[model samples]
Target: MQLPDGLDVGLYPIEGFTNPEEQPEGNGFFITSRYARNGITFGDKYNRAKADSIQAQFSSLYYGNYELDVSSEEKTPVDFSAYKERVADSINFVIEVARKYEERDLKLLNKPMETKAEFNRKHEYILKDYPNAFVNYDYRGYTVYINSGKRLYHFWGRNAKDSGEKSQTTEMQVRKSEPEVLSLLNRFRPRKLYEVPTEQGFCLPYGFIAGDSGHEPRNIGITYRLQNHPDVTIFFQDLGMKPKAGKEDDLNEKDYVIWLWNWQYQWSAVSKELIKPKWRSIEMDGRKGVGTFVKSVYKDGGLNYGYVAYVQGDRQARNLKPDLLLYVMQDSRQARGNPPMDKDELEKLAEHIVSSIKRR
Candidate 1:
């Protein structure tokens, strides 16, 4: 038959299959008697020669028509009439199956899907069987399980090899609640008063207050005297002091001793020899009040400490008189290069002193 200018008769093979199994694979049938027969073979040598000739002729004509189509830029619908249409359909089906398999495999190789429903189903199953498994998930692609008396386990992959594997095994401790931790912090809260009199009348009763050191340093010391208290003086004497040799005579006077005692323990001379003391008096309702002077030991030295002494009025004087005439002195010094007490330790000391003062 005369084929079209851009087509070839050889490209359209005789409509029959060389093998019967090939048609069944596609769920298809061929038209010729040879295809219908049980097992037809012309002869070994002749069949081989015929098959070669058919393939060569088809290749030449198919390539020629393909070149013509390409050169002319023609849009022609592919013809599958010569072969059973099911054969072409079967080939397409195989290709699509392969592509889908590869895509599914790639997804599995990377991060596998973790649907919440699936996780719930697995969790419920474990709860039914084990009843005490701790379930948790982490970002790095795994679900964790820990039982009450066993080690930790994890589930990973699609099959048994990837299922529940023991990741870690250790004895578990019960975790404490937030209230428990808060209780500990409350137990360790800072106290309101602290006293350190290892350095003579240098006692500190520190608590929350506002203002500069001249009025009230958050950390400070106080020194005072009580009238008709000779035996009361014995209590202050119990506090140890580093004696200033040859200066005992100079400090015999009450005010001098107070100033010199505080200075010896509190003041530090950066560049100068000694810190000078000045006195100032404050008056309220024409009643005289006394306060000590504070200046740096030298021009460039710092104000290491200051002392203030005042007599309380009759209403305010009752607590510190006959029972306990007390004065507090405080400085932020670390003794002999020892580290300063931690805030917790200092707070405990503060609370103890305040409690003692209140009891008296």
Candidate 2:
């Protein structure tokens, strides 16, 4: 009955019911939103709590991320146990989800400025970033369809009532803080296990690899890098796949060596200068593998080293299927002696890791 002054555009009642059942005017409410020539439909049941701020969620307000609710319905009924599990899962996937929304928000909320005249000759795109901390996106923080397994709503709007403003944080990038306010339990989510794509029963060294905070390998298989050491990486590479350099080595038996040589060394920063490989054969639990711990220098005069090995029984064995691998790599920046993990320490780590392998 009232026009939404809180909204930039006027909203009009336009709908009857999404449900086919015969219903009175009190069953549900329907409205449509229009911006210029385009518009979207909005609808909700006539029932919901009176305490929530409805328009402040969708309509633009001042800065600061916050939460608001959208109408949800249950296919069955509200399952309290299921709801708690979903909340628990949020801590793990919140960053992943926020990263996705950040990409979208950067585009939608930060619309580029249309130019008539030259303004520094650079096409300006203002508001390129916003705080991504989950707390800041309290509006639509997380929700589910009534008794439905899950319903992911597109993230929108500013922090509720600007609660995030008082904390007054400049600690992380707008993207980093997108999902703030995780508990201690949230911080220590258990490490995920990644089994080797190879048929071997041994699992990859997933415990050591940090979460996908940085340095994702663009390969088909699992790739992980250390949180502290961007230079250090481990990969369970898909055999025979071409490296980023697009060059592929043909030898089938040399995949472990090639996997290492192809990905990092194949990049341009590495020099054409030579450090001949000195690979050693390692045997474990009735299977034999090859490992190489060697160093290479960058064209920029920096140092890097890699340890990669494969398990296919003997070196010449054409055996396939249950291939196992051990790999380690580090760039000069993280390898520099000024840091805590020097060459000696890295080599020891490589040796210890490679040596510990056993038949699953």
Note the Cα lDDT for every prediction shown: 0.25, 0.35
Q: How many pairs of residues in model 2 come into backbone collision?
A: 23
Residue by residue across 1-360, what tens digits does model 1's lDDT show?
010122111111112221233322221322211122221111121132343222221111011001100011113322223222333344345445544444565576764544544432332211111232222222112222222111111222111222332331111101212232223223221122232322212122121112112211111112221112110100111111222242432432245435544555333454322223344443322334343423324345333333333322232232122111122222223122544333344333322332343210
Model 1 clashing residue pairs (backbone)? 193-350, 203-328, 203-329, 221-329, 221-330, 222-328
Q: Give the TM-score of candidate 1.
A: 0.18
Top TM-score prediction, candidate number:
2
Highest lDDT model number: 2
Candidate 2 lDDT tens digits, 110-188 = 8444333332111111122222212222222321111112211122332223233323222222334334433211321
lDDT of 1: 0.25
Q: What ranges in model 2 sit over 4 Å off?
A: 1-221, 237-252, 255-266, 272-277, 313-321, 333-340
Local lDDT at 127 for model 2: 22
In Å, residue 113's CA in model 1 sits off its true spot by: 86
